[model samples]
Target: MFQFLRKVLMIELAGLNRFLLGQDLDLNIINSEVSRCNNNILADLTNDVLSVKSKFADYINIKLGKKKQGEKT
Candidate 1:
């Protein structure tokens, strides 16, 4: 699901880059800005995935501890 969403986002970004390039903008400047935007998007995606993974790990730990406590009784 995440992969699919990421691909879609990338395609959209590529289209945006193409559109920007089609304008009266300088090729070098548009390319640079597009690259920067792509990097920022990737960084944001990585952070979001890491945050979700951390929360899931915490939840699993808490859930397993509860099970262990029940078994002890």
Candidate 2:
């Protein structure tokens, strides 16, 4: 049932994203579930966080090369 719940969460979160940053956060969650994590819950959460980090505000800043991290994209 975890998989079922995860899919629901993903869809709900995706639709609820009013801001694009929130959408990125939702993408990070989906990326987390891409790894099975051996069904370990902690590992799953850790992967979710790691995916957020991998979305690297620094890289995004470099891409725009001017906008700061919290400028509301």
Per-prediction TM-score: 0.79, 0.29
- lDDT, residue 37, model 2: 31
> Which candidate number has the best lDDT?
1
Candidate 2 local lDDT, 1-73, one digit each (tens): 4576577656755554434434545676655654333246446655876776677866786877656544765
Candidate 2 lDDT for residue 47: 85
lDDT of 1 by residue, 1-73 (tens): 6888689888979898888888998889998989998888888888988898899999999999999999999
Per-prediction tally of clashes: 0, 0
Give the range where candidate 2 is weakest over 10 consecutive residues by summed lDDT. 33-42
| lDDT score of residue 20 within candidate 2 | 40
